[model samples]
Target: MMYTVQSSGMLLKRFSANYVQNSTRLASFRQCERYGKFHDCRKRISHWLKAQGEQVAQACTKQCEFIIAQRIRRSLQIFHLYTRIWDEVALKEFMKSWRNRALRNSRHFLMSSIGITMYNWDRERITKDELNGYKKEIEGIYRLRDSTVVCAKCQLRIVIDVRQSGIKYCTCTDNKFNATSNQDSEGWKPYIEREDMLIWRREEPNCGGLFAYKVYGSFAEVTAEDFLQAQIDVDYRKEWDPTARELRIIDTDPASQSSADSHSDVIYWETIWPKLFANRDYVYQRDWVVDKERRLIIIISKVTDHPAAPSKPGTYRVTTYWSYMVIRPYTEFHQPGIEFGLTYFDDPGVNIPSAVTAWVAMTGLPNFLIRMREASRNYQNYKIAKQSLDASDTNYVPLKNEDIFEDKVLHGNMQNSERSEILNGKNVEDYNKIEHTEVPQFNEDLKEEEEEEDSTNSSEEGRGLLDYFYLAKLFA
Candidate 1:
């Protein structure tokens, strides 16, 4: 119950009759002790009522806070699911039918307007004044995700700054925030910076409270295409990536090779761990998006279940995580190269030693970046040899120019050498009809060593080296 001065006054009026009666009796007695006793009793009652009012006020405040928190949480859940679905549907439709920009805009507007209405309803119900300090915290979390939007009237695609715009939908008519032309858009704010590489980690939803880090830097002699090719090529990966002792393609589907669809692949990766540490392995689904219009190539990998390959022994399997690699062209400041933004997160199946984890965290990524560049360069050099070998396997015969003086001289010498056989045989040119071929040279020992190394590193059959995985699964 809420106490007020008006209510107190009414209560006092009701009790005034009793007080008056007592006062009359005391006055008749004309005793100072009787008046003193009456005054003390009135003061005690007032103090008791005041204490009760304070308790009621505190309870009301707590109830209001609880309501506000509940509303915020419910609204956030709605917003998260709504935005995620919106992104998926919009991207699918836009990619599938680029010519239907008008239809796409209408659909986007309808979806976004509905989301706004839903959010606004909750916002008003939340009662901004009641939230007090928690209002900022709730909105900050909601703004953490990037807003995907499209103009309703113009049918132009864009990504708006949710925090800055203060709305979920775009009001742009001229497409100022157009996605295709926004290569220079701001990146994630760095929370961890070292040696010119900025790394920022943020808690993502539906991730079991895990964190993912954004790491981007300029590496020498690497272009957007170079990095894309290097990351995707299976054989080239082994050359540069020292972390992964063995990487294999578990399976792949190329049915989505159309202009509208992206390619997906399932890969198995086994990483090299220290002597004391158990090895780590992963089976992940990777999706590739090579957007020529935006000059961006993105590869996203997420952990996935592959029954073809189960958890093996002696290795801890990463249970959860996703990684993103974004490649873009560099500006003059980072000229003669490209810029790569890499974001990765994973939960190792086992506990990691703090010292080893720290050491790897400090040196691993930088070394990987450096080695990736080196590997790209090596692949470029080795490509010439690879092409020749491929050509020989295909029995490719190249055309030769015979108009030059050197070619005429060689032809004459060959004719001179075959003259004696031609004169002796009834068919003169038969002796000179044989073809000559050159054998392609390659290192057999190196090939043998690579094959043997792969065999040694791969687990035997389906069994793993350790029993802890089985025990954990059984108990889990």
Candidate 2:
């Protein structure tokens, strides 16, 4: 896809000029606040298999284990279409197919392990008419067919029904799968259209120059904070608290223009979702099963053992290190009352991290709730000032800097701007496209076993869509 717009736009910059810059830090977070969504924020998150996690996981395990064990027979028709979309997503996620130590050495072994692929013609052959509904109804379906590919160093691949077609420009992770040099012009335009390419905006008064940023090492620093002391703001809320054994949510963006925001959407555990996911099964996982019952959109994520990039001194510095994060559809929040709720993991704030403490401070709540009244009463005050401030004002006014607070302090969330607009439409046509599909209902059905191995097949090689969800840090 193409993002060639010169309509007098503001260029994005890193938090600092001296920080070491990488594509993720320099390009991803400069315009956008944080690199990843802080999904791990206050999650009842655990690497250990909790009973609840185990039960739901067990249900999914049944399905995936079946697939992994090669025990289930495949219907050529179903496999045909699934293979195409799988190939599409897999190709798009080529960066995620890197070979880890755990990945078998043989090419065929890895290919079988990686994913299933098919073609567009095969998919068109589907007939999802409940009346004529032969349409393949599987979980976790996305289409980026309308989107195009652009690669400077990355080689793109698409395996259709075991056949392979790759783009010379794009390469899978580890630069392993090589595609033909001939780029397909078919999907490029719409594909580009589907992306919310990191936009760079410096509005009135700030004048583009006042908000300039650059990366020196592994950092992105802001050279100036003209209007106010810029600070990071995180939107924290509970998804599912295993300790609490309940799901909670918060409006990370309280002032955001929406009611019933997740932060604001408080509810209790009414049901338990199926736990079909296993920790990265081996460093290079080529297979996963998505059951329509429990998982409609399966997010993948991880918590860095430590900060992604070290922090340094800069007027406005953005660390290059990994932070607790999540990536999902941009519209998830746009939904009337939708908020990110956890089904996989949770936190109880048993031992709040310094990061969470610092986050509270950055939010002008150094003492936390003690300053609640201040914000509660002054939210309107800030709103008035928010309207009056100009882009280049340089007023040095006490800026809300909400986005900054989220990125630097909160380790905010980065929505999945790269959604497959095309296929997502098809999903909508099928099942009303509900934001939160019904997950498994929580129950007392459990037969606890002493223990199981870590099972956390941490894969540093390929990043999963789940990366956007679990990697987010937790305050609890």
Q: Choose the strongest candidate by lDDT.
A: 1
lDDT of 1: 0.46
After superposition, the stretches of candidate 1 with alpha carbons farther than 4 Å from their true spots are 1-196, 202-211, 257-262, 331-336, 353-356, 388-476
Pairs of residues at least 3 apart in sequence or in different chains that clash in candidate 1: 313-464, 313-465, 313-466, 314-465, 314-466
Q: Candidate 2: give its CA RMSD in angstroms.
A: 48.5
For model 2, what is the C-alpha lDDT against the true structure? 0.24
User: RMSD of each candidate?
Assistant: 28.2, 48.5
Clashes (N, CA, C under 3 Å) per candidate: 5, 104
| lDDT tens digits, residue span 1-476, model 2 | 01322111223323444545467654554444332344344243554345478688779979888886563345665788899999999976774566552353344454457732221222222121321121222221122221222232332322211221111223344544322222333211111110111101111132221111100000011111210011111111121111112222211222322321111111121111114322211010010111222211212222221111112232112111111111121122111111111111222112335455333223221111112212222333453566535544321223223342232321123233422222112222332233422211111111233111111211221132222222222222
lDDT tens per residue, model 1, 1-476: 12243355467669776544356643544454445546778888899989899898999999999999999999999999999999999999888787676564654465556632111222222222422322122112112222212334543323422121212334464434433222113333323333223344554566544445556454445444445656776665665444556787765544443323245567788776656678778877776654433334556677776555578988778878666665543322112244456667777655545555444444444334444555554554655665733643211112112232222223223332333211011121221122221111111122457445444433231133222121111000
